[model samples]
Target: MTSLLRISTLITTLSFSGLAVATDVVHFEGKASNTLPEAVANFSEYNDKLEAVMEGELTPEAMSEVHQLSYTLENAIAKMSKELDSLAETLEEVHLASESADTETVSEQGAAYLETSRELVE
Candidate 1:
């Protein structure tokens, strides 16, 4: 009975402490990568670190690390998403032009697409 009481008390204490921690907002002060290339590099680096951290037990410290890393990762993803959206539009234009036998539009848009894509792939 005594052990059960102690366990209940401990659980209650931990629950409150968790709530306190959850209420606090942690901010990432590090500068986010500005360019697409820089954002891509940051995404790769941070994602590797985040994966490594996740492979182990998720203790408080590891969770904190994850929280901090997520900010940079999110920024990278946002930049990539924005750039890729524009690139996809360009590729679509190229495809449409090619279907209509518009050689000039196809050539222009195709080159633009390849140049931007190479930056991501290579």
Candidate 2:
């Protein structure tokens, strides 16, 4: 009887602990930027905000805010990563053309790469 009672108490404790963990899960509904320019803007803004919030000791409230801000940051990074992947391919074309001394291909792909890259820095 004592063993059964002990098992029952353990089960109850486990159930409550699981409930606590479930309640602690936070859901973020932040919107993602649709365009590269929008993503760049969001990435810059949220990155600065996140850095500012991390200056002091992290309280639960600050941690929660950081968690929410991370959603936008993640979205911006995803968009930028996709665009940069394409840009890298273009730059590769320029590199290969330059190596072979193909001035026409080099000029065309190099110009294309620089145009897109300038947008990213500006």
Candidate 3:
């Protein structure tokens, strides 16, 4: 009986703690969506430029610029991907928090997500 009581107490503590960490999910609120599309468009344009460079002469300056553009595009894609992942994870967390009625967690996560997304856009 004592062991069962201890287990019940532990479970209750854990449940409350989990609720304390979860925030509410907001819909269509972050700049992550807008940034991703812009990033994709930039990638397409960069790829087209890269193709043109490849087809043209292989001068030292041209090669250098190509290298720089490729690096920039790769970094941009990676940053955008990270932003997307952050937004998705935040959304999932918010959903779970909402299911458990953890409003504080939801609000915190939503605000953080929005801020991060805005930074990504800038």
Candidate 4:
């Protein structure tokens, strides 16, 4: 009975403690970690290669089918880089929104809740 009571107390403490720092999983900074510059650089190289090949600098193909394909890849890279930048900014905004929300209070429960909430956000 004592052990049961102790376990109950521990669970209660943890549950109450957990309510303060609730982290929203959608951190709004979605996919900011995806490297864009590296990708753009690689595609730039592909575009250059395609240009050289098409121009006959690389034995300039009369048809330039491959060169055209490379051109497409370069455009795609540029588009992807722009998208990544936009996404990173969007996430920053979301993080700011979450931080700016009014959650602090003064009572013991409120303080505990505030700490927990901050922890969850952090």
Candidate 5:
């Protein structure tokens, strides 16, 4: 009987506690809404300064220097590509030689296997 009474009391306490928590949440949300506009203005000012710097509105000459560097990099890449083509031709010759050597080795191994088998039979 005491356990049953204690359980009911606990349930009642929990129901009231949930209502109290919900009311507090609403109050805090209202407070936040009241202050949000000032916060947004402050953030807007900070963001505008950041945008100006990142968009290079801070220096006109920086973009020209960037353009020159980009051109140089493109030329360098073209030169390197030409050199790699020559290297690829040389590597292709080496690959063919290695394939020929492999074929010769396989033939020698086959001949040696026949000779060993004949000797074992004798």
Candidate 6:
């Protein structure tokens, strides 16, 4: 009896945990909705600033600023890449879920994919 109770409790806990993760994905989707476009804009601005610095004179302070701007641009590009990768994974999951006729999972993954895709595109 005790073992049975423990098993049931464990199952319930695991079920709730899955639900929480699903809900959190939706929240992340909302946040990701704006992240991609902002990263792109920042990347462009940083690239332009870096270019101007490179084309101009090469003083110590200018070199320092250029390095900083280059670092910032690299970070932005990395972030965009990560978001794109995540979007790709979510799309694959959505496709698999649909193929398996798991509508709920497909919807959740689809929403996540859409959010990430929107962020990646201009």
Q: Write candidate 5's Cα lDDT for 1-122 as tens digits.
A: 99999999999999999989667622111111112233333334434544555577536465444443344334444444554455455455455656777655455554544443343232
Q: TM-score for every candidate vs. truth?
A: 0.80, 0.77, 0.45, 0.31, 0.34, 0.55
Residues 1-122 of candidate 3: C-alpha lDDT, one tens digit per residue: 99999999999999998887564322231112246656666666778888888898989778766866776577558767877887889988888998999999899987877776676444
Residue 6 shift from truth in candidate 1, angstroms: 14
- The candidates, ranked best first by TM-score, are 1, 2, 6, 3, 5, 4
Root-mean-square deviation (CA) per prediction: 3.3, 3.0, 24.2, 27.3, 28.1, 21.2
Model 3 Cα displacement at 1 (Å)?
99
lDDT of 4 at 40: 52
lDDT of each: 0.91, 0.89, 0.72, 0.52, 0.48, 0.76
Question: Which sections of candidate 1 miss by over 4 Å?
Answer: 1-18, 29-31
Off by over 4 Å in 3: 1-64, 120-122
Report clashes for each candidate as comma-separated counts.
0, 0, 6, 7, 0, 0
| Regions of model 5 farther than 4 Å from truth | 1-58, 102-122
**What TM-score would candidate 6 get against the native?**
0.55
What is candidate 4's lDDT per residue for 33-90, written digit by digit as tens?
1344544554666667667666674443534456355545755566665755665565
Overall local distance difference test of candidate 1: 0.91
| lDDT per residue as tens, model 1, 37-121 | 8888999999999999999999989999998999999999988999999999999999999999999999899999998888786
Candidate 1 collision pairs: none
Instruction: Answer with 1 or 2, whichever has the higher lDDT.
Output: 1
In candidate 5, list every pair of residues with a backbone clash: none
TM-score head-to-head 3 vs 6, winner: 6
State the displacement of the C-alpha of residue 100, model 6, in Å, after optimal TM-score superposition: 2.3
Worst 10 residues of 2 by lDDT: 25-34
Q: Which candidate has the top score in TM-score?
A: 1
